[model samples]
Target chain A: MSHPVACCYLKTGRALMSTQRPDARQLPSRRIADDLRQAIETGELLPGARLPSERELAGQYGTARNTAREAIRLLTDEGLVIPEHGRGVFVRRESPLIRLGNDRYSHKYRESGLSPFLLECAKQGKTGRFEVLSIDQAQPSAEVARHLRLPMSEPSVLVRENVFYADQDPVHRVTTYIPWTIAEGTGLLNPEVGHPYGIHGILEERGHTMTRLRESVSARMPKPEETRYLHLPPAVPVLDVLHLSIDQDHNPYELTRFVMRADLTGLLYDTPIE
Target chain B: MSHPVACCYLKTGRALMSTQRPDARQLPSRRIADDLRQAIETGELLPGARLPSERELAGQYGTARNTAREAIRLLTDEGLVIPEHGRGVFVRRESPLIRLGNDRYSHKYRESGLSPFLLECAKQGKTGRFEVLSIDQAQPSAEVARHLRLPMSEPSVLVRENVFYADQDPVHRVTTYIPWTIAEGTGLLNPEVGHPYGIHGILEERGHTMTRLRESVSARMPKPEETRYLHLPPAVPVLDVLHLSIDQDHNPYELTRFVMRADLTGLLYDTPIE
Candidate 1:
């Protein structure tokens, strides 16, 4: 029951406007930023194209050097451009979009020896790996407890955390939770399950074959810790994907939350329309 | 093939860190912003709670008032808080998350008189409406043309643009394109389709019964025009959903792009994992 805060005034027909006219009263920096942003969007400035130096921009726009610097900072905050320490600023090149679809969970692929991340990376000619952060028993959070149908008073979940990487760059931080009943005396408690099918494969062997998956997707600015872990740039948001795997008996057996760098991830879903 | 730009350095095991310690060498403004950001994230400062006055924060943190102001500015840019014209700053209250699921397109709901947006609003107890921005014939973009399998040289699509609002707050900007072959002499060309079944119903009547749908989802920062149209706050990213409708004959019939405010919208997909 999250309530949206009132953040904007009601405006009509604004979208139909053809161009964003430069308002005479706008700050000089904003006008400059808008010009550069349009150029980037319209392909005038391609990805990885270096922007004119602040001095040149200032001279061209007839603004102060600080005004030009502020405009660059504005683009940097929007994630449109990156400023190198010694080099000039350039448009940020996007990562290859890895489209995750419903078929990704199919048994055919699950049995393919590669984990889903690695499989997707292989499809796109990129190398993928993950580092296990920890595997330990922990009290389930209220939301996790509700989803897993665990008793309120029980500390009954094994938490496995990992950081997934694409070509050595951190892309997603995944935290998985399993009920102690399902995790105990199983490979689920270990960081490396040493199975081609991974954790889900082990679950299947224990009769918890996944028949369905429900994904809840949202996005938000990364917290400081996530920023550090993901090495996210300023102003880049992260996709928060909450996945629940349901077994044949309709039991929600597993819950995993993936915090992914939005710039590098795309989700595709092809489903029969009911 | 969108390549992810190398944005972050390789980092491992950072997620296991217990706390984000304040670095002694960090700038005063950054350190102050970090403290305030931590307060906001940890619920020490609840949504809508007023932050301390700049003078108070400066005195408390042994920093200049300008430094305190800069810290607050950082929070504002991150969309963690908002400042009033005359009043002090307060933590931003989030909008209620609208969970859009696969069932939203079910024929049962489509037959219910209300449009999909209105139906969802009824369920959520929030008023929803949309303003038809424009309805006109246009040349399809290359992507749209390819999806509809249209000849490259034809102005062969009718485009309908609308802005959806929940509780009077704009939340999504949608642009739908229908190949002229399907749109000719149909209600689909009208801004208001004037039918309970909406556009899909019209497509069905015209022998294009939708059997499947494909949605490609990505996210990024809003362009300046989007910021104005959606009334987005600084640092709020948007979800870009590209939708294609496939008919029973496996013909792609419709293509629509929905640019949604990430802060207020969530997408839910419940599907059997094949």
Candidate 2:
């Protein structure tokens, strides 16, 4: 259930070398990358293991040090390695991936008063922390307005923006927009909200029980602000997951927008069919 | 229902500018990009609308033409704009987003012999097409091995690889691996298996009905092979959706790996809560 990232990475092992030789024009760095990549896939080079220095790689392969460095760069772009300025290159650690399922939003978790992030982190044997970047009364974006079924000019939202971190690594930055009507007279407008249960519990307690959730998932290059805050490498994209929470009557309530680091995360969803 | 991509893009309207003034040190291009992004978000610059030429932008902003070009480049990188070689830059159009829920695999769809992809595309009002890339019995990848619960030592799979297109645009490339045991007794080995319904229909008719599906989603830069086959621009990310199909008895049967264009596709999953 955990380590989804590792499982996905292992899928690349499908690239088995064929008996046929490579094209004569293939770059040396590309060939080097393929062999190193194969080693990583087969577990010959485990995560957290350091690769040989450029000089060593060049000496062994009889190629330019820059060419060896380029091979390492290729692996880094593939999310298989990370280069620390002066410390050399090391295999990237595959974090315990995010496994989001139907159960996380259960009344059980709500009753026990634990934020989903906190519960998920604890379940994965990691400490979770969230910082409230800001909380304010603001104009709802057009999508939020649509979800809340309000004309854009007339609606406002209680925007609670926060970033969730597992230990020291910032994993996701979320902005949850709650309509003024649904948020009014509830603790949701407060920056602190419902301590243990979070806003969902508060919403449920207020008679607006969530009956359904709609989520749309996409990925894109991160914005400059996100690049700085998320510490994402140049090549890794960001996952944009938007969630819409609806009450028992299917009335929409909160819309949370998540900008997550793609390299460090994988979303797991399961559904039963007839 | 048809274009999930367009709906997701409409979501960018979530950014409502703040009243506070920004600090003066922001880069000129960054500032230019933000304002243009806001215009796009608010619908002032609609999709497919051509952006001002670099010369016009520079003249209007009293900045270098190169600075203006950089700003447009920023938008293109964000997927907000597309630059067609000599045609200049224009707002990117939204394609039909893939809103895949649990229903596409229901008994009704299977009985009606509707392939999930066709049903999905039709519901969105988009024409769908599939091109078979290759069909062969081959060694299953480790992920497939794990999904089918077979030892790495033995077991092969009937691999069916295909590319899907929406209208004229290549949207997704899918490779499905079925264990030899499950595939041997069915028509799934054929390049064209249970047409109109695909493999699931044949499996259902054979009483190996799929009862559940588990999906994992991740994103990264596309491989050179994928870039060439999928016709993906260098900046766009690819969504890697790996799915496992399980029968009523909870035994895994099929493993399908999809490499979809992230910019043109979004997966919509909805579920009910107690």
Candidate 3:
């Protein structure tokens, strides 16, 4: 639990004095990492640029090889660099960011024969497609049931899971849950739900037009399953978005969760002050 | 760059067979970390629960002490656990999550005698306050200039930097940029702008009543300064929000950037579809 650098500071009686000036008290490795991070942030080092080898860094910083290695490890853990076997470490090259705005769900775009994700990709000159992972009936979890306003006695809800890809790279793992009364004996169960309007269109035709939406957004390190599915890089987190669709009568009809790679996604919200 | 365990698998000729099943091919430390992560996620190990000591874990798993340490390090890096000085490692106990929804900006709440951050904190029974870091005139960064439609000839904008606290813990570091044309002689440049409406009210009186807003949200690791300001734990990312305010005449007036701790904030957006 003790850091050698901290011990050195304490022995010198500098730790107490450095409390008023924290930057003066930082470990050598951390200072080196901070300088490299600033270089990356300011575009002094471009993406795919190779960083100096550990030995070179050690020579430049007048530190031990282990100290240099720790600096590089810090950048790797920040998702700013990737080290290749037998090759040098290079700055990470990020995919084009996809911005999801509230207008993506506007009904006006529904007639364009494209789902929201596809439409967004088209606008950005990126190809988008989704693979239907599963469509089945399952008992809704407590959260899902509450969001959909289904009673505990309800038998089951329809679950449709899909992995969406942008430019052939997996970006989102979406799982949608629909009430049994609304999804039973419909095209909702099919893997191929015709596009343009997609599932929302089908729901609208069934007297449940989505008039509103509620989205809760948070971020965290990706789970192992998410890391595997999204092919996430080291230290990359995922944006967890929980979405709810409500009808004109205030009925919450559907609940969907989107797990998106944080490195390649941004969320935008534009609304009135009222 | 070579993993000893992977080398062992290759030596035993099990590498190829295990490729089809990733879970079966995981390194022992990773498997152990995943098991602990699931226990945390499923609430089996509640927040503040102490994990088994490293020696106990090593004995139980029949592994080396270093392997047990690595497993614990993985959990620590994921922000799931914290190692205390002299005490055993314990699960991280998060503060109550503050949900920031669009309604927080509704004009009706402007009369509540509290800023949005303070209002939200009050609702959650937490005290919120802010300390003005600085107020000065600075040339707008390119991005800020573009957002405010300030021509290159424009000299500078009023910059107000503040750090907001929730229950005495710094949660947001906000930097607001206002066009000099609107803030030249206004109270916006003053550290104390009074309560309730605050700077916004002064802008409204100057015929810049904000009617619309656009927020761009992304997540990434905290910078060194942010890590210090927010007192963030290791491996915890932060939410970066860029906010632009527009008046009824569609004039973009204010630009503010909010750097918030991901562990303590959740952004909610509830809006009607067009």
Candidate 4:
């Protein structure tokens, strides 16, 4: 059984402040997280056991609903708890053990232009599935306008927002946009039904390929909707990665914006020597 | 005049509630940062502008001392501001733009049994200098203990600490611990002087080398000291990457904890065919 990780005093020689183990009364939410964490560790709360509703748990722990919820979120992020939509949260049977390495990505891009990461997902039975949220052939926002190099007057375009799940759990959520005229001629015009090929794979097969790709990564606190969809805790960080793929002619083909559960994926890189 | 970054809107669409647009009532510190950003875009600030001192800038902007300092820190993480200890912050006149995608780490490892990432640093240029922080030849921590297969009582000896900058700005901060005792034997034992070889390079020379590596990536809010060392803004995120390297016998050689500036580095990966 695991307990709250007890790290030895690292700054042992520092004399500025006397160090003492934080007693139970120090922090309300942290104390709740620890109390519940102890229960989970000691088998008082078995794996897959349905935890009490947030309000009940709050009352039991003698804390506010928000504090109890926050504690649950911490355990959730640590892979100890699982929250089910429209259902009570449960203890996760096991933590997701990820193997972080670069072997899969290099093989895909070298042998086939298809992203190896995507290929590995398929092979590992972690095939990507999308639940289309909303689709619109609307005017591109200023940001999209610049990325796609469309004139401000380029009118309405196609925008699709969806959540991508692996093994029935939401892992990423994306909102992608493209010029309507360009997309209208393509199969992506149908938002209700997703094509067998992801948009990138489809684009490559159609010879409207992305010869160059640029990406930017950042992180921020998740908002309410994102937190709900991701089932993430307030302290759990998300990876905000923006991908811009351009054609051989340097014409931007697509601009994809997405957030991924950082714990689920490791960024890998192998650059060509100059 | 530069506009407030659009990122805040993507985060919270209710921009009206959060953002205060550039107005006459704007604080001088904010105004200073905005003005400098605009001047950079317009080539007025140029590169390497010896920025006004914190006190001077506070006087110029009619703002408090702390606010002016924070404004500069924000720009520093944006890759526009460069600060020097004892010297005033400057507009980064010329700093090597380190490209993350140009070198293939795997191939270098396969050929030389050592990575260029370590070698290149040891063989420094005018701008490159590696400062070794604290080095402890002591027992591994709990995380390292599990990886090195050391019993709770049996000490799996190691060293852990940071790598500082040549220009006194932190390039990357890392704490690496290895199980092998050769690390202590290899004349690489002092924090006051730089090491002749880096971790990987030294391991290769010692004849126990890693053929592959695995990295786990995540991001988090930087601790106060980390933010100051990395010269990061409180809002800016830092990449927390952990690398585990195994030797030919599949024995773990090193466990490295690294924190990189999310904005400064791009991580790329190419996987091999299965």
Candidate 3 residue lDDT tens string, A5-74: 2223343434434445654636767767877888889998999998888877777766677777889988
Scored against the true structure, residue B152 in model 3 reaches a CA lDDT of 86
Interface RMSD values, listed in order for every candidate: 1.1, 2.0, 1.2, 6.5
Task: Looking at model 4, give its docking quality level.
Answer: incorrect
**What TM-score, over all chains together, does every model reach?**
0.87, 0.75, 0.87, 0.50
lDDT of 1 at A170: 89
Considering just the first chain, candidate 2 attains a TM-score of 0.81
Any runs in candidate 3 off by more than 4 Å, and if so which?
Answer: A1-28, A38-44, A55-66, A94-96, A194-197, B1-26, B38-44, B55-64, B194-197
lDDT per residue for candidate 3 within B1-274, as digits (tens), equals 1122232334443443445564463676776687788889999899999988887776666557777788998888778899886799999997767777777667777777766677778888999888899889999888899988998888589988888888978888889998998998888877888522478889988899888889998888886678899997887788888988889999999888988888887788888887
Off by over 4 Å in 1: A1-25, A42-44, A59-62, A153-155, A194-197, B1-25, B59-65, B153-155, B194-197
Winning model by DockQ: 3
lDDT of 1 at A261: 91
RMSD of each: 9.9, 11.0, 5.5, 12.1
Sort by DockQ, best first.
3, 1, 2, 4
- Once model 2 is optimally superposed onto the true structure by TM-score, how far is the C-alpha of residue B13 displaced, in angstroms? 43
lDDT of 2 at B71: 86
lDDT of 2 by residue, A1-274 (tens): 0111111112443433354376532465776777778788789888998888877776666566777788987787667788887788888877667655656677777666666667778888888887888888898777788877876556978888888788788888888887877777877767675432377778877778878878889988897689878877767799899888888888887788889898777787777774
- Chain B in candidate 4 has what TM-score? 0.56
